[model samples]
Target: MSAEEVHNRISMLRAERGVSRKDLAAALGVHYQTIGYLERGEYSPSLFLALRIAEYFGVPVEVVFSLRPFPRLGSEVVK
Candidate 1:
């Protein structure tokens, strides 16, 4: 099947969790470069991989990836 453009919050979530790509990749049982590829949108992860990542980050899969661009945090807030 054709892969969809799955935008994700991988970088942001990893940063917030103080996780390096290598650490996350090791936890996900993938090569460290796979994390880079995912972060750069150069590769789309399989559903199982995506779910595993979501579990690692303590968030739902939808919170980690979306088919459409997600709105920026606080973008809905007024000054």
Candidate 2:
């Protein structure tokens, strides 16, 4: 079976929190380049890493990661 792509908001969260990739990587005990790979969807994080990322952002895992694509910002609001 083909592997499903895991979607994430790591980049957005990092931006909102004023975090640098190197800083985040250091916090997560991963290589800085790994953060770039994750942001680019070129690599998928392990479950443990995903949970750690969510914990770092003080948000639920679902908020940070999703199997389906997340809606654009403010797209849920009705005009």
lDDT of each: 0.94, 0.94
Worst 10 residues of 1 by lDDT: 1-10
Give each model a TM-score.
0.91, 0.92
Highest TM-score scorer? 2
- Cα lDDT, model 2, residue 54: 99
Q: How do the residues 5-75 of candidate 2 rate in per-residue lDDT, one tens digit apiece?
A: 99899999999999999999999999999999999888989999999999999999999998888899998
Off by over 4 Å in 1: 1-3
**Candidate 2 lDDT (Cα, 0 to 1):** 0.94
